[model samples]
Every structure is written in structure tokens, then in C-alpha cells.
Target: MMKTFLIYAYSAILVLGSLPQLRQAKKIPDQPFARKAKSIYRTPATVSRRVIEKTKSTVTVSGHEKIPDQPVLFVANHQGIFDILVLLAYLDKPIAFIAKREIKRIPIISKWMEQIKCVFIDRSNRRAAIKVIDDGVESIKAGQSMVIFPEGTRSKGTNVQPFKSGSLRLGTRAEVPIVPITINGTYKMLEEDGGRIKAADIELIVGDPIYPEQYQGIKHNQLASDIQEIIINSID
Candidate 1:
């Protein structure tokens, strides 16, 4: 009973603590400086002092320099909510995510995500999904990269699940390079199946870029699988 109570308390605190940041995020504009202030300023370097003080959940990244300067599609393994925060804190470049349409309803976060030009996909509506992909392709053409979890949801474990081929089409259609990234240990930080969160070390290993040319004549589903394999192999 005591442990359960503590877990509940911890969850409540985490939620409430994030509320203020989200509230502040809503008031910010969708400009570059606003994004820099909201996303870049409250980064890994100063997050210990400003946001969550649990610096114990450290993250180490590699192959970031290998990222192409031009916009590319970043397809990574989904672990937990922590993956977003981890990337925001560590990644030097400004990138947006392909969030669900439901997240757009959240009070402050929705606004923040919108201001940052994050693409929202309504998977339930086929037309909307295609439109979202089109918008994402346009964003890439405009030199803004996007990070998408091709698994479509948190993996809830160390092993990655199958990739959804829908988002993969954005990369190929736009002729953008696909960068496969492996994110490990995030599920330990905050597993979706459970509400509780625990401090855990995180690692991000970015592999070499895979151009559409390499996958010439390959099926979209097979392309997604090949990319997922690269991410899974990088994790361990």
C-alpha cells in the first residue's frame, strides 16, 4: 500500500510539475526564437536546474555529426515519452515531431507543438493521414527535419516492434535521406503500460544515412523493415 501510494504521489507530481511549463509554452509564438526559448533553452544542460532535477537519467549520443545538413526524415524506435524530452535536451538541431491529432487537444503542449510546426496525423482518417504526410514532405523540402516513430506507439520493452510503412513513404516521396536512430533505455524511464517513472540511463546511437537511391525498386514495407533492423541493431 505504501509503495502504491508513493507511486501515485510521484505520478501526480510529475504531471503537475509539467503543467506550468506547458502553460508557459502556450503563450509563446510559433517563431524560431520562441521555439529556441521554449525547446532549446530548457534543454538538457539547464533542465536539472529548471525542470526535472532527476539528472540521474543521463543520456549519451553518437553519430550526430553524420546527420545531413539538409532536411531528412529521422525514423527512430519508440520507447516512451522520455524519448522526446531526451532528444530535445541533447540534439543540437531544431527538429519537429509527427504527433497524433489527439495531442493537439492538450491545452499548452498542443499549442507548443503547433507553434513549432509539428505535424499532426489523424490515423483514424485515411485522408488526413495522407495530407499529414504531404505536409511533412513539404516541411522537409523547406529544410525542417522531422522525427517520427515508425512503430506508431511506445514499444513498452527493449525490443522494437514492426514499423508502419505509411510514414516511410514521406521519405521516399520527398527524396529525402532516411536517418535511422536507436533509442535505448527510455522505456525504463517511463513505460507507457505503467504510470510510474524511474531514473534510468539513456543512449541514442544514430546510424549512417540511407538514401532512397539505395532502396531503389524496393517495396515500401521492406524499406521500413530494413530501417527498423538498422535501428534495432544499433540499440544493443
Candidate 2:
């Protein structure tokens, strides 16, 4: 539809326009790069907000104040592609994603993702997947907040899927708080309509932070299940 086409076209323009800022952000020294990268998030955030507005969609967020000041792992349900855009546009804190390796092949978008410290995982290869976890842990320890959809892929509906326990190691190894975020209704924006963009109201709920002390001794499978339940229960 025209609406969907315009959304993509405008987003392409926004990403292309941000090339200069991305170049400047890349110049920051490695030691302070993560700190400086937070500023760069504003560009993508603004772009995402504009894109969401282009679709005439609305996002209602709650419990945003629950996010801690320190870097934490954000584990959330993946409802649809719009889930990422919604988080980028609305979440107050700057965060990166534990994305699939295929996304790294994207042109300008992938470059921006790198600037934000997103870790790419190759789930097909066991060793590569382990290395991805190590990289994510290192990024978190370096002060970058990261997001992972334990479902591994979008469910394309409201039904919450079982989370893969291995992804929880990012928070465990980094010893940071694990925040459970529940994203509802994003699928209505695109996936529910079979890829057409539609006006939809979305809800994002930030659950209480599960700190290191609370989950320190818990098995990753148990933690993943507990977090999955928390997210599922928060959905409208």
C-alpha cells in the first residue's frame, strides 16, 4: 500500500541523512566510545519516532521509571518487527540489541546498529553462538545496555513463546540487572495485516528489575521461564 511504501521510503531517507552523524560518532576513542554512543542514539530514536508517527500509530508506555541507572539486560517478547522501532522510539534509556547475524548484512542500518554496540549471533553454528554470548557479555560489562528477545524470533501475535535459556547468559555473565519488558500490539502495526502498515495502539510495560542477587543462583532455564511468564502476564 501507499502508506507502507511511504513509511519505508521516509525511513530510508532518515537513515541516509544520519550518515554524517554516524561518521562523527565513530571518531570517539574506544575507551569512551560507549558513553559517547548514547548521544548518537538520539538520531535513530528520532527517526524511529517519525516513522511510527508516519503510520499514525500510538505507543503507551508504563513503568519507565523502573529502569535502573546502571546498564542492564532487557529481556522482552518479540511480537513483530515494529517491536524494535517502538523500543527505540520510546524507551528513555539508550540500548543495543542482540540481533541475528543476517541483520548485519543490512546497509546503513547495520552500520548504525554497530555504532550502538549491537551484538550479532549466528544461531546456526554452536561455537559462533557461544562467541556471540561472550561478545554480548563484554559489551554489557563495558556499560552498554542490551536487549534480547528470548523467543529468538517474532511470534507475530500476542501469544508469548517459550524463551531460549542460553540467551540469559548475557545478563548472568555480566552480573547486571535483568529487566523484563512486555511489548503488546506491535504485531497489529505490520505483521497482523500481512506486512501492510496500519494504525495501531501499542503498549510497552517495564517490569521490575530482577537484580544480580535475585537471579545469581537460579538456573538460566528457570530464569528464562520466570521472565517469560512475567512478560506474558503483563500483556493486555
What lDDT does the true structure give each of the candidates? 0.73, 0.90
Predicted candidate 2 versus true structure: per-residue lDDT over 1-236, tens digit per residue: 99899889998998899889889878876576567657788988999999999899999999999999989999999999999999999997788998889998999899989888898878789999899899989888888888999998899999998999998999999999999999999999999988899999999999999999999889999999999999988985
Q: Each model's TM-score, in the order given?
A: 0.79, 0.97
TM-score of 1: 0.79
lDDT top scorer: 2
Model 2 off-target regions past 4 Å? none
Name model 1 segments beyond 4 Å from true: 1-55
